[model samples]
Target chain A: MPGVLVIAEVADGKVLPVAFELLGAARALSAEGAGPVSALVPGQAHAQELIARGADVVYVAPESLAGQMYDAWLPAVDAALQQSGADIVLLGQTASLGRDLGPALAFAHRTAIAPEVTALKLENGRLRVTRPCYGGNARAEHTFAGQLQIASAKPKTFDALEPDASRTGEVKTIDAVGQSRITVLSVEKVESEGVRLEDADVVVAGGRGLGDPSAFAMLEELAKLLRGAVGASRAACDLGWYPPSSQVGLTGKTVSPTLYIAVAISGASQHMAGMSGSKNIVAINKDPEANMVKAAKYAVIDDYRKVLPAFIEEVRKLKAQG
Target chain B: MNIIVCVKQIPDPETPASSFRVDEAAKKVVPAQGIPPVVNPYDPQATEAALRLKEAAGGGKVTVISLGPESARDAIKHALAMGADEGILLNDPGFEGIDNFQTAVALAKAIEKVGQYDLILMGRAAADWDMGVVPMGVATLLGIPCVSIAKAIERVDGKVRVTRVLDDGFQTVEAPLPAVVSVSNEFGEPRYPQLRQIMLAAKKTVQVWNAADLGLSADQLGEANRWLKLEALYVPKVESKVEIIEADSPEEKARILAQKLRADKLI
Candidate 1:
């Protein structure tokens, strides 16, 4: 059987969170007798972490791959796959590199492509992948009978397999078509405060109930004290109280945090789809009967003006003691 | 300045979801015909932005490219109706199931094949899959700086100033000629295509390039080069029932709600 290739994205000289997630999934898939799970980390980084996370073989290219330039990375990935003899390749869904690079790699490799896949399995030797369609309203299953299969794994939906401290793997460099046709003239990284919504372990989102954007300060403070991120319902975003980036719904980022706090959110199905997977949830709204309250592990019915300050105090207290 | 706007044809998502189905054996989405396809919402915004830039520049050429089945002509026509000077459609069976990466490569190839454009414009994300990855991939393939989620773009002599919507607020950046930008819906509503222009768009030639014509090998077109896999697909199940708490009096309702809030530690 052809071995599986796991493409790990390295950004700003660091292996991204999705790399570990892909490793875990690749390991599980390989364990089921699909093929060997070899990781392709196309940057100047140590591959030991990949090996520890269950990558049987790791490919590393030091000099030309460190930057998150898609132009440079595409050829690097193509070179790695060609050398690895991987018939099945996997990637993280929508990582900084994965989003742009994943599809290009698919086209380059001429393989069937599936993205936002939430689950994977092998049935009778065929590779099976599943992803949401119709804006999370339905799910579709795909099985590639061809020799090669490629898919992008959904983030925050799977556990990152634990690394074996003692596990060791080999790292080799592969020659690629060098000299990128495109060049990154310059790069500017945006500065952000508090936890990034993508990286947050906890997220507190508000809706129109917060009244205005200024009131979002309370949610921001609460998020800061919790070491989490703040989000808003589509309503809040539409009301111009928050930027679209902070909006949580079908059109925004799909977040699955350890704890999700919903305040004054009406719990539209689309918004729920984005965050329904949060391990624990709490909701606060004036409506004693709100859809979000039913989805919460804990529910509160009160004015945000009264409850927000108290919650902030409690979080501050917890942080202070720690 | 030559501005190229890449557009896509998609089933009108606003059509109730119930109208579609999967041809599992065929491994394809069965299109619900009769329902018209439109320019992916963001593409028009990008086109409008390009038009504005052109209008501001006094005059310039606006070329639109769309890749899909032959039906994709509708998308190109839509762009042409909106004042694009020319349109091209890349139609071929080999392009089916081509993921974002290949789509970008094909697009980059098309742009390169066409040759000479100062700016490439695109929507921040597509309605289908909504991965928002194409413009970046194309930029990478073309080796240009890509600014996504752009709310505005203004051309000033040698460069373009872009207002990017960041998570917290916004940031303005300037880039020299030859850059890729994915315009956001917030860029402003797109203008409607005029009647005479619509008629002219139909008669104007829509250049069709196939996988063969683009020199894209079968391997470079579809699943053979795909690098990602969907592990599984099932309807996300999240069920919640309404919570109704009736109060006898207005004051009592407020008190009850307040009590619930306190219990949850939200107040």
Candidate 2:
């Protein structure tokens, strides 16, 4: 049977959550008469968790290839792809890995790849992937005419499967050439105080409607209380209100948290494209007809300045009660 | 140093969401009326990156290359206005409707024609397709290494050192000369062209080349050689049911919202 292969991404010696998310997506796609889902990881450390997440087979590479560099991972991935004979390959659309590796692999395999895929399905035995086009103004369904189909899905687009310790799968070790032309001299990481936006369960994002850059301090306070991350719209970033790294939009970062709180944001398509995958949305804006209010699950039609302090107090009270 | 920066013309990305439409049968976006096309937002940053590197080197040439219809000359002009020395337009009827793979082939061929370039730069991705495949594809075709999503690039000891933006943080990587790098929007806003520069840019002659000029056959340049097939394109149905919280005071509303969220097990 033609199976689906997922590239399990690892960072800093731990498996990133998106790796399981890709396995979850692979399982769902294969459930409807596609094929068994298999995962390829850089090392054997996380092979068991992958099995519990519905991977029927786990291909682990040598330990030396555990870094996130594309050159290090490419050889092992190529080997797994060949050995599994999978017709479809799924990878997480990550900033560090997928963005570069997906295209390079597509060129190497002489196939096409859909990046930032939001949805996937099988029709007439062909894999059709849906991705945003025209900066999220429209969705395009793309398929491959070649033998192997490769695609990368945005993080948090799929729900991870519940892990079952009772489940088990076969684990195989794959050979890696470990050859690369580029040399990594040094890496500098800006350490943030709170949870990273993509991994945060709750995110409080501000926009130009916030009126002042200082207003982000309130959002940061709220995020601190909730143990979440703070985000900003591109407009706010363009206004020099926040660091560009914290901007969430089509041109910026794509974040899919469980609860996205939009403070004074008027849901432009570009901004919405980045966070529309949030499981729940709450908007605080004076304009009831604003795009954000319309798209939110719950909306408070009041100025964020009027709503935030009270909301923050209530959240504090609830937490205090616990 | 000689740098080749690739720019693309795209529909205005900031067009209001309400005006955006799709042609379902044709599987394409219907360009909204009254919104003039602009340089793909990130392309300016790429051009800016090239110009900065050239300026820092004290003496170098920067050439802008674009692949699109005749109207795409404006994209090249925008780069020229930003101080690029020359512009090349790969305009041909045969280039229409080509996918990213074929697009890369054409760009690689154009780079070869240009002959001497120590660096090739492009936007991280075109705002329209958001595929971000061309830079790597072109590098693969040219047998060069590629560094992507670079927010800052500099010439260090005859090699290109780039500060790349990652999900959690950033990393600095170095690649040899004659390499490809795609600049991210984090490179900061591109410089605004002065009026005099714009006039000079308009007067500069842009060299237009066809597929034959690049030694590419018509059969290898369009949808016939595309690896990906467009199955369908349409506006996704957005269904939203918003529950407006009502209360006499902000405090009451906040209390009720917190209660509702807890009840729904969302917090």
Candidate 3:
């Protein structure tokens, strides 16, 4: 039985939560007779943390392998894959390293990969998956032609297992490196103020229909009052009405908050792709026929300018009463 | 500094969802009837990036390349209209139904045929498939460094310096000449072509090449040579069961909606 290997990703000196999600998915496949599960980490010894999350074995590459260049990091990754004997490999996302390294590995190894898989299943030692296609308007179901498979899952699609301090796993250090062709100058991680949009339970987003940048102030106030975060449609971000950091769309962040509020949004397919997974959706728009209004679980078909202030006041009154 | 920019043409992304259709049985997107395919949105920014790099280098050739049916020439022509020096269209029946990998292989061969370039540029992603796989794929085939989602690209100390957009922030990295860089929309708005430029571009050199021209064969192209098997493609059914809150007044509606949300424990 071929094993499953997860490329554990680290950001800000800690293994990303998505890496644990990969392990969670891998452990399930392992339980289904895919053999053991391994987490491949470079630059740091995250073995104990990963094992607690679900990895059966952790392969640690030398610190040098953590260098940002995709070419410079390929060799160690290849070695880890070989040593772990994993026929199926997984990454936490399609952005960052996954999009770069996933296709590179597939091309280098002369194999195929479905890099943005959102669903996965193991059948008779083959990996079957479904991925968003045609700009989130559709999904493509794919099955590998051979046993050696590579895929990267969309973030937030899988659950991360709880840490088990008693769980034990092996840590094997790999020795290999690749030729470096790129040099990093600086990495700036912009720490957002307050709750991060992706992690926020409630999100109040505006769109171009807001008509003016000042309208975002109302949204910010509402978000603050609700102790949530502010978001925006791509149109609003592109028009500079709000920061690009707050843009919610296929090209931006994938958010699945418990509650997502859309103000003056038309709910383009791309925008829907990002926040459609929210547990509840509320649309405030003047256009009764807007796609957002139709897709929303609850909709107010009136001018957001007229509706939002009163809505905020009502929420405040409701909170005060309770 | 010679630069190669790969462009593509696809159905307009702004085509309303109401008209967006996919044939489940055919496993294909039924092109929206009224919208003719336009140049992929990102490719112009790529062409603009290349044009700017050429201007900065004082003097160099900017060649635009596209791999698709003959209609793909519009993509090359769009880049040319934006002041690119020349265009190449890689078209062949063998190119049909090719996956990203095969597209990369054909493009790599075309780039090699185009010969000697300091840098290659492409849109961060094709707006249609939303697959940004080709740049890295081509880079791997050519054994060149690839920088993704570059908001800015400049030449410094004979290396390509890229300011990249991150999920939460930005990072700057430098790679040597002959590298591949995917230009993002953040690179700034691409310049629009004037009427004269469009006419001049129409008269500029537009080379049409087939698989044979690139030393490619039917055996090495299309579905037969693909690696990933597509089992199905269909538009997901979106059933809108929205509950419209009805009230005589806007304030009343707001209060009712808020109360409803509070009742549901959403707040």
Candidate 4:
């Protein structure tokens, strides 16, 4: 029986955390009578960690597939699919590579891809997946109808297995090198300081209610005090009050931190979907009935400008007392 | 140069969650009262990308294509108002309840019928289905390369250069002409048409073509031809339970909320 293959995504030579989460999901499928779980690293990577986290086999491809460029990654993934003959393949649902490569690969195979699936199961030798749709207002369960099953799993939807050094797996180097017709002129990486939004335990997010770009300074201060990262809503990002890299919504980064503080956000369905998995939520909004306030476990129905400063000060005092 | 931009009309994504409803049995959204459908938010960004490329080329024809219901004409008209030179609507009863693959088939057919194009532009994803696969599907069928999530698109020596958004950063890549590009919101706001342009767009004849005109049969278009099966669609029930912090002043309210967090061991 063909099991699952994880197309582990890489950035700056580091295996993204989503790779391990996908292995966890793949292992679950294997445990349920699907065959062994194999991982495909499209670049140079250590197989020990992936193997420790449930991958039975790891195929490391050439470094050309390291970046998110579709043309660079597609041939390697295609070759892996054919060589491994895996029935189901998974990729991290990153906006850049996964979104671009998954569909193109599926189309190349004369099939289609299931995008941003939250949950998936192995049912009667087929793959059944649930994905959010309609701007996250609804979820649609889907099944691949006798086609090669391919999906981009949403980040944070699955937990990475606890790594165990005792586990052992085969690491094979594959020569399925990728060559792209597109010319890469230049590459520019955004200079980011502190924890990335995805890795942050606490996320202090602001919205259009901040009213001015300068307000992000205070939000950043609070994020710094909490040793967390700061994010923003689509509206605030579009308004140029914050960088688009920090936007938190369906169209932007999907963040699921331990604590998500939504400041002055209205909590549009799209925004909530991105942060819905947050373990706990707090809202500071003047509107009592705002969606953000309603969804929050703790809410202060007052102007964020009025609440944020004092909230920051109180948090500071409490931390100092400790 | 000639460019094609695909647009879609969807129920307004800005509708508050409180008013959004779904019929689990029928698997459809209950149209919120008095809210009209609008073009998918990202479609305008794609349109902006197309318009910018056309303008940069010194001269080019930008045609907007939409595969949707009769209301989809509004989406086509939207692109026209935003400096598109022509509009085409791929409308047919057979087009209803089709998947993205079928949608891509029809759009690719329409592009073939148009007979001339250097680039195809589309939003990264539609707000309704939000699958964002049609562009790639079309590009694949056409045997052209596709670059998605473009923040900037330029005509570099007759080749299309796109600055694409990646998971962590950005990369600038160049593809041959007639390639497909899907624009993201980072491309910046689209140009809002002036009154005169809107009036002119209203009068332009939007050529309507059905599935047959695209040489597609009814059997090739709808539910039976779908690649993926929809098992169930439902509005997930989300219970909102909030503990409101009440106090005489903002400072007091802040202090109380902090105390509550400490008690919960969250702070």
Best by lDDT: 2
lDDT of 2 by residue, A35-90 (tens): 88899987788899999988999999876665546766778888888888789999
* Candidate 4 lDDT tens digits, B199-222: 999999999998889999876777
Ranking by DockQ: 2, 4, 3, 1
Give model 3's DockQ, 2 decimals.
0.74
Compared with the true structure, what per-residue lDDT tens digits does model 1 show for residues A1-322? Answer: 4678888876656677777888888788888877888887765455888888888888886555654444456666777677777777888755345654665565444455666677888777667877666555557676663467877865676678887979877778765634533334344555557688867888989998777678888888878777789999877887788877777766677788877888888676557768877876777778766658878866666776766776666555544654
Q: What is the C-alpha RMSD of each candidate to the true structure, in Å?
A: 5.9, 1.8, 1.8, 2.0
Off by over 4 Å in 1: A42-45, A93-95, A175-177, A209-211, A249-251, A285-294, A301-322, B9-39, B56-58, B65-82, B86-120, B131-235, B241-267
| Docking quality class, candidate 4 | medium
Candidate 2 per-residue C-alpha lDDT over B56-120 given as tens digits, one digit per residue, 9 for 90 to 100: 99988999999999999999999999999999999988888788888898999999999999999
Query: What DockQ, on C-alphas, does every prediction get?
Result: 0.21, 0.75, 0.74, 0.75
lDDT of 4 by residue, A19-69 (tens): 899999999889887788989886545688789999888888886677646
What is residue A37's positional error in candidate 2, in angstroms?
Answer: 2.2
Q: Rate the local accuracy (lDDT) of all candidates.
A: 0.73, 0.88, 0.86, 0.86
Interface RMSD, prediction 2: 1.5
Error of 3 at B127 (Å): 1.1
Here the TM-score of candidate 2's chain B is 0.96
Docking class of 3: medium
Q: How much lDDT does candidate 4 score?
A: 0.86
Please state the error at residue A220 of candidate 1 in Å: 2.4
Q: Stretches of candidate 3 above 4 Å error? A: A31-33, A43-45
Per-residue lDDT of model 1, residues B53-111, tens digit only: 98988888999999998888888888899899999998888887766667887899999
Q: List the residue pairs that clash in candidate 4.
A: none
